[model samples]
Target: MSALIDRFNRRIEYVRLSVTDRCDLRCTYCMPKGFKDFSEPDEWMSFDEIERVIAAFGRLGVHRLRITGGEPLVRKDLPKLVNRLYHLPGIEDLSLSTNATRLSKNADSLYQAGISRINVSLDSLKPDRFKSLTGGKLEKVLEGLMAAKNAGFSPIKINMVVMRGVNDDEVESMVEFCIKHHFTLRFIETMPMGETGQSASSQYLNLQTVKKQLARRYELIPGMMPGGGPARYVRVAGTDLRIGFITPISQHFCETCNRVRLSVEGTLYLCLGQEDKMELRSLLRNGITDYELERTLRQAIDLKPERHEFNEEPSKVVRFMSKTGG
Candidate 1:
C-alpha cells in the first residue's frame, strides 16, 4: 500500500504542498493586484488535513516535503506544522518556499521548529523595482533573509526569476549579493505562467542569456549535486557560494521529475505546468480506503506527462505556477 512510482521509473519521493492561497503581497507575475480580497479563507486546507496527507505521502516513499503557498508564512501557526512534519519518520527533508516578508519575525521560530532549508522569492535587488514587482517592501524581505541566516538556516536558497527588461540588469549584482552573503542564489528562467501571459511575452530571459551575462564576470564551474535537485550549480570565479539555475524552459528535467504537488484545495497535480489534477479531497471525505488512495496515486503518476510543451505559447500553459505549487 506504500508503493509509488511513475512510468519513467522515477520514484515519487518529493511532494510540494500548498498550505494557503492567501498572500499579503500582490506580485505582478503571479497574482493580480489585491486578488486576496476575492479569495475565501475556508477554501484552504486545514493544518491537520495537510499533516494527514503528508503522512500518507511519507508512507508512500515521499521523503522530501516542501511547503509553498501564495506565501506559506501567511498561514498562521506555520512553525507548528513544520514541527509536525519534522518529526515524521520517513520525511527527511522539510523545506519552505516563501516571499520572506513575514520571516523577519518568524524565522527564528521556524528554524527552532526544524525547517531544513528555505527558498526565498526575491525578484529584484532594487527596493523600488522590488516594490513594483511584488507590491511588498524590499526591506522586510532582506530583514527576513538576515534573520533566517542568523537563526542558523544554512545554505539558504534565493530564487530570482529573471525577466529580460525588468531585473536582468541585477543578475551580476545578485550573484555578488549571494556570494557576499554566502547564500545559494538560483536564477530561474521565467516560466510561461501568469494571468496576464507576462511569463510568455514580457522578455522571456532564457538560461543561455543568463549564463552568457554571468560568464563575463565569473568563471562558471560545473558543480556536483549532493542530492537530486534541479539546480545545476556553478561556482562563481572568486566566491565560495555557488549559483544555480532551474531552467525548466531551456533545460527540461521532465525525465528526472521526481516530484508531485498538493494544491491548497487538496488536488494532486502530477506536473507543475499542467492543469489536469485529481481531487484528493473527494476521496478523503468519502472515506476512501488506504488501498484505494494508493491505487489513485499510482493512476495519477501513470498519467503524468512525458514533458510540458511550455515553449508552445502562453495559451498552452493550462495553469499558473502559483496554483501548481511551484
Candidate 2:
C-alpha cells in the first residue's frame, strides 16, 4: 500500500467533498444578504464527476469520505450519491455533515441508502436564540434530529459553534440535552473565515474556559471518537453520550490533521484554514484520463502545507468557511 504524506509529514487518509454551495439557512457567520448574485449555479460539479474524483483519490489511499455543503440535504438525489460512494473500493466509511433542518424527511432515505454516520449543526437550544443566530426556525432542526434518531442513525453528532455572548450560556444546557437524547455534543471554536460575516471582533469562548465550565458541572472523562475530523473526544461523567472540543483557532490541530477538502466547484483545498487549493475541474472537463487524475491527486497531496498560520498571523489571508467546505 502506498501511503500519501503531505509536507506536514501527516498521512492523508480522509476526504471531504462538498456537494453544493447552496444552503437554505443564512447563518450570520456563513454569508451575507444578496450572496445569490455572487454564487453561480454552474460552478457545481456533477455527481458523476465527484464520483470520478473520489475514485481517483481512493487510488491515492483516501478511504474515508465525508459529504458536506452549505447544507448537504439541500442537494437533490443525495441518497443516490451516497449509494454510489458506498460502493467505491477501499471506502471504509462514508458520512455526512448537515444542518438537519430537512433531516426529518430525508433521514430514513439517507440511512437506508448506506450512510454510516451524521453530524448535525445546532448552535443554540432556545428556539428564539437559534432563530436569531441561524436566521431560521429552530423547531425544524429539532424535528430533524428527532427524525434522525428514529431512523436509527447511530452515533448522531451535534456540532455547536460557541461564540461568546451568542450561545455560550447554553453550553451546560446543550450537554444536558445531549445526555438526555444520547447524542454526541461537539463544541467548535469560531475562526476568522472571511470579512462577509461575523469577524474577529466577535468574542469566541475559548476551549479552556468551556472545559472549565463543563468540568464544574460534570466529571468529564477523556475518550476517543471513531473516524475523527477535528474534535477531541470526551465523555460527560456518568453518561454514555460523548462530548468533543474542536479547538482550531486557540489550539490548532494542523499537526494531526489527516483530511483534504474538495469544494463543490471542484477546487481541492489541502488545508481547511488556508486559501491554497488545486483546481481539478479543469482537468476533469478536459477529459483527463483516470491515470492522469490520480497523478493530479498526488500533486495536490504533495502541496499540503506543514501547518496553518492562523494562530500567529490570522489576518494575513481570508476565506469563508462555507467556501472552504467547513
Candidate 3:
C-alpha cells in the first residue's frame, strides 16, 4: 500500500475533514460578529464525493479520520455520513470535534453510527461568560456533554483555549470539573489565524506558563494518549484524567505534523499556519477518476511546508479558524 509521506519524511496518516463551514454559535475567536461570508450549499461536496475522497486517502494509508466543522453536529444527517466513513476500507479510527451544543440530541445516533471519540470545545463554565465568549448557552453544552458521556463515548476530551485574564483564572476550576466528570482536559494557546484571531492575539497566554501554574498544584507525569493529534499529554498524579497542552505558538509541533486538513469546499490545506492548498472539489465534479484523485492528493502533499510561520509572520494566514475547520 502507498503512504502519504512528505518531503520531511512525515507520514500523513490522519486527515481532519470539515463537513461544513456553517456553525450554530458565533464564537468571538472563531466567527467574527455579523460574519455572513459563508459558502453556498451547492459549493459543499456531496456525501458521495466526500466518501470517495476519504476512500482515496484510506488507500493511501490514511486510517485515522477526524470529522470537524464550524460545529460538525449542525450538518444534517451527520450520523449517516459518519456511518459511511466508518466502513471505508483501512479506516482504523473515527472521531468528531464539536461544540457540544447539539450533542444532547445527536449523541446516541452519532455514537451508534461510529464516533467512538469526541472533542468538545468548552471555554467557560460560567453561563454569562460562556455566552459572552461563544454566544452560546452553557447549559446546552453541559447537557450535550452529559449525553455524549452517557452514550458510551470513551476518553471524551474537553478543549479549552486558554487566554490571559479572560478564562485563565478558571484553569484550576476547569481541571476540577474534568476530574469530577472523568473527561480528559486539553489547554490550547490561541494562534493568529484571521482578523478576529489577530485581535485576540492580545490574550495569547503561553501554554508553558499555564503548565507551570498547573504543576504547582498537581504532579503532572508525562504520558501519551490514543488520539493522533498534536497534543502533549500528562497524567494527573492522583486521577485517571489526563491533561494535554497544545502549544502552537510557544512550541510549534510542526516537525511531527502527520495530518492535513480538508475544507468542506474540498480544498486540501497542507498546513494550518500556511495557505498552501489544492482544490479537489472541482476535480471530483469534473468526473476525475479515483486513480486521478489519488494522484492529485499526492501532488497536494508535496506542497506541504516544512513549518508554519505563525510566530515570525503572525499575519500570514487571513482565513478564520472556522473556515479552516477547528
TM-score of each: 0.94, 0.96, 0.99
Q: Cα deviation in Å at residue 307, candidate 2?
A: 1.2
Candidate ranking (lDDT, best to worst): 3, 2, 1
lDDT of 1 by residue, 39-139 (tens): 46676667776777788787788888888987888788989989998998789988889999999999999988989689999988899999989888999
Q: After superposing candidate 3, which stretches have Cα over 4 Å from the reference?
A: none
The lDDT per prediction is 0.81, 0.84, 0.94
- Model 2: lDDT of residue 96: 89
* Model 2 lDDT per residue over 111-201, tens place: 9988878999999999888887778899999999999999999889999988888889899999989999999989988776676433743
Q: What is the lDDT of residue 277 in candidate 2?
A: 84
C-alpha displacement of 186 in model 3, angstroms? Answer: 0.3
In model 2, which runs have C-alpha deviations exceeding 4 angstroms? 196-200
lDDT tens digits by residue: candidate 3, 1-326: 58999999999999999999989898887889878899987999899999999999999999999999988887889999999999999899999999999999999999999999999999999999999998889999999999999999988999999999899999999999999999999999998999999999999999999999999999999999997899999999989989999999998999999999999999999999999999999999999999999999999999999999999999999999989977
Candidate 3 global TM-score:
0.99
Better of 1 and 3 by TM-score: 3
